[model samples]
Target: SGDLRIEMRDLAVFGEESERAARAVFAAGKQDEYWDYHNALFEGGEHRPKSQLDDDSLVSLGEDLGLDPMQFKQDMNSTEAHEQFDTVASEGQSIGVSSTPAFIIGGKPLLGAQPTQQFTDAVDEALARAES
Candidate 1:
């Protein structure tokens, strides 16, 4: 449960929108080690990017991360991983969220890429409300 992943789905970064680096991260995500790819992108943000996740680069990165190239390839095409990811997305959509990083805390909605302080303050308030 302590897994962190960043997804860039439904994207077609070709032509004028050829973000090869960004696409590479998404392509890497197709593998089980997408988290590594994501963290790498974040760490190297703007310094050097792929503009899109090319297959060759994704494979190379997975190998660089010490992931079994074969397993990573298999997992990428495996229905199990995609289904698991899709289930969460589908559940979120059913629950009135169409965007990313949606949350439910103390029965209240906290949506989008909110700051840590906002969540911390909300949780603190929620605790107070529960106490009262």
Candidate 2:
């Protein structure tokens, strides 16, 4: 909806592997391929096991997404990418978030997975508040 804008923040509460993956995503954003990489990583959902998201897998995903392999790899391992991931993770922590799939609408925390209706209701409420 034009009235709503969604911003995704990565919180690596899952562990080091998740942190690395998050860093890779942030790095991908620099090349204007964040969504492509993100979608590719989670395309099959549960069918795509966590074990397959290692450093090598991340680079391969970048390559598959048409990103430059060498540049993508360098960016993924860069200090800037690590810093960006840490910054976002810290922002989530400051808001009492400690897990993935968390949503915040109009500064209200909607922790964990929710039904479609819950998101719709939150969006409606937020839009109403914004309009007022």
Best by TM-score: 2
Q: lDDT tens string, model 2, 43-129?
A: 866424577768888888898888998999899899998888879988898887887678998888899899999999998999899
Report the C-alpha lDDT of model 1 over 45-93, residue by residue, as the tens digit.
4433443345555556667887677766566445654555556556555
lDDT of the candidates, in the order given: 0.56, 0.84
lDDT of 1 at 23: 42
TM-score of 2: 0.86
Identify the leading candidate in terms of lDDT: 2
lDDT of 2: 0.84
Candidate 2 off by > 4 Å: 47-50
